[model samples]
Target: MIEKALQVFPKSYVYRNEELILEPRNNVYFRLVDVETEIDFKCKMFAWVSRPIAKSLNKYWAPRVLKSFNTLMDTNFTKSDMYLIYDRLGNDVNRKLTIRFIESGYDMELLKR
Candidate 1:
């Protein structure tokens, strides 16, 4: 139940035509992604690290966060809902949600790449 985030809007809105993904791990494969390949963080994807620090949620409490999100936002999102459709975490998404990594992706960069 590790957590990874996808941008809901265009990356660097100033560059509207450029799309970017924020990946911070070595092997990040969504359960329903169906593909078995290493993700490319080059192109337009920004390696999920900054001057401060950041990282994806570990395989421990991601589900709970999602649950809390569902409860707090009145949405019905499940683990299976991840990466299974465009509405969840992909391009042309149909929602207006923004990711707030809180402590997860905040200072973990000190311990990870």
Candidate 2:
């Protein structure tokens, strides 16, 4: 299942470290920074798109999916200072989306599963 998900929506590694942190803001955005550089990358959530039928059929499902994504970030990340750009499209429909980095060298390739 994870392999198939990766094939559909590849996990883009924004940062790699022994301990990476992610913090979601009320504005629905996140900022990531290397603790050493003091420079940070800002990210914002765009849209939450799911399978058209599933989206239309269940109203609460989208939020649940998003919550799952948030949980994943919270559990996987080490610090809460970093912000995650929540792309529902990636989590829901398994579609890969672009994650713009405010700082350089932040974009990375996901580790092979």
For residues 34-111, could you state the per-residue lDDT of candidate 2 as single tens digits?
323222111222122222212332444434434443343222221111223222322323223333322323332231
lDDT of 1 by residue, 68-113 (tens): 4344333454544332322222432321221221223312232222
* TM-scores, each model vs. reference: 0.27, 0.22
Model 2: per-residue Cα lDDT at residue 92: 23
Give the backbone clash total of model 2.
4
Best-fitting candidate, measured by lDDT? 1
Stretches off by above 4 angstroms in model 2 are 1-57, 75-97, 102-113
* Candidate 1 deviant stretches above 4 angstroms: 1-56, 85-113
